[model samples]
Target: MRIFAFVGVFASVVSLIGCATGLTRAGSMIRESTDLSVRNRCEFIGTIDESERMGAGQGDNRRGALNRVRNRVAELGGDTFLIVSLDTDNSGAYVQAEVYGCGTVGSSASHAPATPAPSGREGSMTTGSGFYVSRSGHVLTNAHVVEQCREVRIPPTGTAEIVARDDASDLALLKNDIANQPIPAIFRGGRGVQPGAGVVVIGFPLQGIISSGPSVTTGIISSLAGPSNDRRLFQMTAPIHPGSSGGPVLDDAGNVVGVATAKLDPFVVARETGDIPQNISFAVSAGIARAFLDAEGVRYEILPSDPALPTENIATRARQFTLRIECRE
Candidate 1:
């Protein structure tokens, strides 16, 4: 009886180790999205559904389900899988994906569209910033950045498709075709916006003029409203430049509270009002962004709150999802 009990315990440990190894390996090769464009070179490998046991923690359950989905795709000889949908029921967390095979070299080439040269009157290229919001490759940026653009490039990633846009809100969503998984922005839900909260901004400003890396700025949420008391906007003291549009306004907890949109034009405002506004910038509140995503039926992640992260750590994490948006008109 003692020998049998010891054997059972040892077997369970081995099984857990095997599962962890498989998940890590599978995660390294799989890419998730529903926006693959290279069907000509790849063959469909059928859809896969994966679910995992859930306890009190939804985060752990979701991660487990995603890992299972990736593992199943790898087992079926598929290099990429597009996440069709994810949901949770009373029983567990579940994810469904469509698998594809495009040969041993991988399907990255098939996923990207051919790059075209700049053309027409808006032929010049402009750069801005954006960040990923969903695991399905959905990115959020200012609509103007990609407006009338012939091609949108998210550097170190790949070409992106303009999936949705709201000119009124100055927000746009892009679907990228990259093999690497993106770290999504954590929206700060249930946390009310407060005056004088510490904030940070990350983006690629001035491109070649500055270093090729994203720049970081720190400040505080100066006001809860914007010009004319626009409650949908947050007036922050964080300095923003021309290229800073569409970047995220993150709280000390590293949760996104708003989307950097515009700043008071000192020249124009001063000419009209005879007063120069300094360090006056505005960002669309996270509530507005959440509503936009909801209207578009885009799924996103949210966190209740997080322990305050160090400035360096926050910047490092933000860089993972923050991308340089290049537009050729």
Candidate 2:
């Protein structure tokens, strides 16, 4: 199915761009609809708040931003949308829209669209985890986490820019706009990490469902390598959940040793091996992350292993640098 998207500008009226006047491939399916009757009949999906070229100070990237909102509407199984808000910020323009699912263009709606159950899910929003790598407010997370985002924010700090992304290594570096005295993670030199060593993972797992702060899971490095003998990863027994990607994995001394990445799917493993695996996850080695930061010219610190601290104490310190990553696409 093709997408038909057009969002009306609000009182501020930032963009002058309009919909295609004639039918094309993608243009024909999802067209501009100012008919309130059509909008009234459709069930409301949710609001899409997106920014274009945010924090870039170039002004007016509305066209690109609205296109992303349309794609997102289609992804949510919606067929039409109406711009509820469009305004300019200090750095860029943004649009907030309401997406709806009406039947075919000419036909009467057959069934009412099901609104997603309010089971604590961030509806039309995606959340992940990240940690500060430098005092300059540079953050490191999995590239996939921010690749699809139109606006990446670290809560009260506002918008962040994707300074660099490495799909090959599944790492991305983000530079936040405000330098609000952020706590940067101190990585332990790569030489000391070993199998069977105790590690702590600090992240926002399950986001809205769990406590607002970070969650701590403790485990040991199960192997020195990952699946298929990937040496850049550490196989660990710590739990990695949906919103836990890119979180910091710390050793007993409160030094970051790796970045939490993935966990095995129990059902998939069961289908392949006739058994279930539990607490089996992987994190990119901190050594690899450190190298990526260095290549990007980010000022991060790496110190030798220090005397071990209590697990709770390590978690308290690591939590300062660990943060929740909110992505709007």
TM-score of each: 0.62, 0.64
lDDT of 2 by residue, 71-175 (tens): 888787776777776666566667788887664321111122323212333333456789998898999987756756667788867888888887666788998
In the predicted model 1, the residue pairs found to clash are none
261-298: candidate 1 lDDT, tens digit per residue: 77765543443356977887788889988898887788
lDDT of 1: 0.69
Candidate 2 stretches greater than 4 Å from native: 1-123
Q: What lDDT would each prediction earn against the true structure?
A: 0.69, 0.69
- The worst-scoring run of ten residues by lDDT in candidate 1 lies at 12-21
Model 1 residue runs over 4 Å out of place are 1-122
The alpha-carbon root-mean-square deviation between model 2 and the true structure, to one decimal in Å, is: 16.1
